[model samples]
Target chain A: MSGEASKAIEPKVLWGGGRSPFSISYGKIMMWIFLVSDALTFGGLLVGLGFARHAAVTKGFAWPSSEQVFTHFPFTHEHLPLLYVAFMTFILIISSVTMVLAVEAGHRMDKKKVAFWLALTVVGGAIFLGSQVWEWSTFIAGPDGDITTWADNATLKQNFFLPISTEGGHAILGMEGPQAYAMFFFFITGFHGFHVFTGVVFNFIILMNVLAGTYEKRGHYEMVEKVGLYWHFIDLVWVFVFTFYYLV
Target chain B: MERDDIIEYSLHSHHSAEEGVKLRKKIYFVTALLSVITIIEVLVGVFISRSANEGTGLWEAIKMGYIVLTLIKAGYIVLVFMHLGDERKYFKWMILVPYILFLLYLIFIALNEAIAVGEGMKL
Candidate 1:
């Protein structure tokens, strides 16, 4: 009956499936669809985080200020809030730029330039991952090495969740009141970090392909463009993660 | 490869040297723009105090500023870096509309949930 109805109506050829109306390849279109879905998943996690933070704030529970908790900079004794994260953000942005360059090089069939830029992108991704691991370790260790487990609630409460009023602001030094902050921090950034890890791996594989002249034989570098889209999506996700997780 | 596959593969030809240079320059400009915005965001986050009183008007404004700036950065990444801007309009909308609508819905739900939680705590 549905087929008869469609035959009677005979809509435009756009949905006839003989050709793509989008003028792009099927693979790229599929990539975009996958990315949109991934965006929703990440959005859900971030919104949940915001909800938790708001609830904590409403309950008069001191939320762990990003300034206080993320203050430690490597090899520096002084408190520096958001500096290391800014550095990592820059690294990711630069890597994104390199990825675009690689795609452009591929467009021109410049195999050498494509390999060069892809290698740089891989390095940048590796560095960002290293920074995230260091950050996770520092957070888990706590400032005074006191926040280990829930069993050590007595000392943990005193040392880790202290809400001391500092000269800068109302600083909640460690995990703060409910300890949900640390949990959210771990889960969200850990998820994004895992993406970066995969991105690095994918980029390395593509670079190897480029070096082996695989795309050269195929007469196109569409694989690089595809991976470049994924890489940029990773960077795009980081922009939101940085804003929600650290800045706001 | 199939005849259609051969025809569909990379319809655009290689860029000339000057065109490549121009493209690289645009990429650098975008990189610089993103970096500058990120630095501003960091400065605002670190220097601006969110006093003991949560949900002050000023703090809310700053939060909004962060979101707007992040959106701008995200736009550049998607449109320029991902080459979404170069695609046809229908494809662009098909890819972007769902994402925009979903994110806006999530943000709405988040705000409402927070408000409700706050009100509950008051009671």
Candidate 2:
């Protein structure tokens, strides 16, 4: 093969104003920029979450354990703490792996392999969405036992002495304003989850295109690379969410 | 470097296609190591919670430790798994430094507000 012909086989460098030789597609570069902005948005939300938590602390409001509020599963009376969320985390990680595989296939110009991996990524993403729905349902359900909505003037002593379940499988009284915290949790996490849901659908469309040999005929899989960036960004966001919302 | 030169260099450095296989294995190893650290963190958090129900100063310290460890894990994910470390230095700074600064600002404001509110309750 001539030097030019051999060079044509190499992947094209996309953006970066010729400052770097890093060979990423233009679509992928744009996706990274988008992800940076999106990351900022999530960071703001998390900061807001932290602020709310701090405010509750300052107001003499005792915060409920995440284990207590996130307890309970749909279609069953038994309480399963953290299991649903753990399952969701696993699903998202698996989907991320599939996405990486798809990107790898694209590198080799294997359209069929790319399509198969993308399909798997889409399925993993759908399972993650379903898991999120289950998690949200459990979150909205509140505690397993009798729940009381306290008045604003309810004394700290009374509020703190109120019985609440801990993640340790024991009940302790004294936490306060769990409902308020729950509202923030639902809103912030639900927003992130919605983003993931949209990403999955978008990825599925790309998968279909690959299967139809559209990208193969076009001589590039930049679209797959672009969606891969988005998919990875979602995974990145989840890492933070899992830490702050659950573990922390 | 020219496109052909880059490819030729990469292939030459590898000495064979097996290098790609070796690189993939390294990636998996790193990923597994990170996952293990995460599991350890969860276990530590659970253990700390069990013994420190009263929210003592010691429990607070443990919570801080948990938060720090979580940040470390996140940093690893971004730097290693996301290939941010392999990118140009400018890109790395562009993505990471701003995030760190913003996160610190949020933390500072949150703690300050919380402290202010706590003091107000005592009045």
Candidate 3:
């Protein structure tokens, strides 16, 4: 009876039926789909921004130059334009490099190295978020002059406004107010910053896991690899933001 | 299972591990190239803007050029760094084709809407 039980037949089962062509590893495939959805949202925001600018132009409101609008530092009277934004871009790029190194270390199962790289990535991300806060504050402060001038080829008109004078005496030209740009700025960048913040927090958790020897117990750092995917996606989004918002 | 099979498997493992290192180096080299191109694009944009003020045809062309360079950078990042280039062909099309089509649709709708809004504001 024991020999018969040991040699008992197994039931037949079908394998690999109805598999998805879109499938990679679970984490990677999900990231791709998430990116696709996120791209749509960003496209909508950019298109809306374009529409707003066009409307302003048609209404004889002058578009503020990118250089002019983003020209202030926290607690400083000196105005700087592309320099600060370029610094922010550099910070984000360095963070991306740190993320890549973390993933590399994870592949080798070097928990200590992964933790170090992830820590650096988090610090870089925090610096970027701080810079973004400063940028937004500068943007919302608005221009200085009470009267903004509007001009086309044919005519020049002066529009009077309350002297909501801030620091520099540059006139706030075009539109009813800076509220439109300010709102969009906060919304789009805030959204992106939130993602960066989450990525940092996620990296921190993985770092903790590495420190706790959980990954060692599991004998693999697949979790670290997955989190790296999220980190890289955040960096990719920022590249697009820098291109469209600042450079273009 | 056989002695030769074990030897072959060991050799394959050694070869693939070396290949992986080479692949990573290639990816790094491409990333550096992309960074250089990005700097070039930014410099060109600055020079073009300085030479031709806003609303000039050259300024418009520069703007278009900036967009093109950005797309190129994006393509390289996805293809090389993200390993999309090494992915299965069907998977690549499944992800990219829809994205391009949707982006084009978005551009069309956005431009039309912008024009309409511009016209309305003019009126």
Candidate 4:
């Protein structure tokens, strides 16, 4: 086919052959596709959380509010509701900003700026992960001590009491709590924390490459951009997680 | 294969100094916007008291507002931080539309199943 004839073909022909229809690199397109699937995975988890929460609340269970549960901040005995988690959210966001700055520097082929920003991104991710570990431990420990109890598993049916802290102390069945609340809290945030951990590793690897002048030798920094996409996706996921798990 | 021949690598050019300044400004603006929204959400979550059985409408309204604000934050992250906004229109929609539809379906199914479970328990 002549060039003129191919050019005259329908607009659908944009995806017909050798050229990239999306105007993005193959790596980038693949990254985005993976991100979309990842997002669905997270969405499923959140939706399940919503279902469990609704069922528990409708059954007259005074489901533990986030503000009530996440009241501990490091190095302080004061009752600070949701303060530490909010601080964690800011850490993730600042990491995201640094990541985008690295990508922008990549576009300009500014090796120094890119490395600086990428290092900051890694540090931010590490801090967030540490904060998550602290938060999870605090949650599991509860206000007084180990908050969950396991009961007899007779007839292959496991029974348990999931304690949520109230104004006075922990309570069991018919109290203000839902077992699934504690379960979902760990599951969803743990999942997002895993993402942050992965993103940190990825950013670290890319930062090393930048230090080694790999992209500089390659004449472009699309690798940085691809990893930046993943970093930002972590932050984006945290937005929803923070909103649903903490705020709502 | 050498990346020099790849269309994707060739697609971007170095930003001019002015463009760099503008991009930095936009990044700061988005960061500020995200921070403000987050602070507002935190304040609402902390300060607002929702008693066990009182002012149901206000609580619902606050919940809806929270969702909207969260969505706005998500949009800015994807569009600006992820640079999805710079991509082609079809590419943008291809990435966005599916998530929106899936989220709507998820919400519907979650509510439906939860209601069914609740009624079954009542019985």
What's the count of clashing pairs in each model shown? 0, 3, 0, 0
For each candidate, report its DockQ versus the true two-chain complex: 0.45, 0.23, 0.21, 0.48
Full-model lDDT for every candidate: 0.79, 0.64, 0.62, 0.79
Q: Which candidate achieves the best TM-score against the true structure?
A: 4
**Model 3 chain A, poorest ten-residue lDDT window?**
A1-10
TM-score of every candidate relative to the true structure = 0.86, 0.76, 0.76, 0.87
Across residues A72-99, which tens digit of lDDT does each residue of candidate 3 receive?
Answer: 5556656555667767766876777677
Residue pairs of candidate 4 with colliding backbone atoms: none
2 or 3, greater by DockQ: 2
lDDT of 2 by residue, A179-243 (tens): 55655677777888889988988998898899888877766666776787688778778877877
CA displacement after TM-score superposition, residue A54 of candidate 3 (Å): 2.3
Find the candidate with the highest DockQ and give its number. Answer: 4
Ranking by TM-score: 4, 1, 2, 3
Ranking of predictions according to DockQ: 4, 1, 2, 3
TM-score of chain A of 4: 0.83
Model 1 clash pairs are none
Q: Per-residue lDDT tens digits of candidate 2, residues B50-116? A: 2245468776776677677767766765665455665555557876788778778877887788677
- Looking at model 2, residue B78 earns an lDDT score of 64
Question: What residue pairs are clashing in model 2?
Answer: A58-B118, A160-A174, A162-A173
| CAPRI tier for the interface of model 1 | acceptable
lDDT of 1: 0.79
Residue-level lDDT of model 1, residues A154-237, one tens digit each, is 434334454534657755343434477767787888899998999999999999999999999988788888889899999999
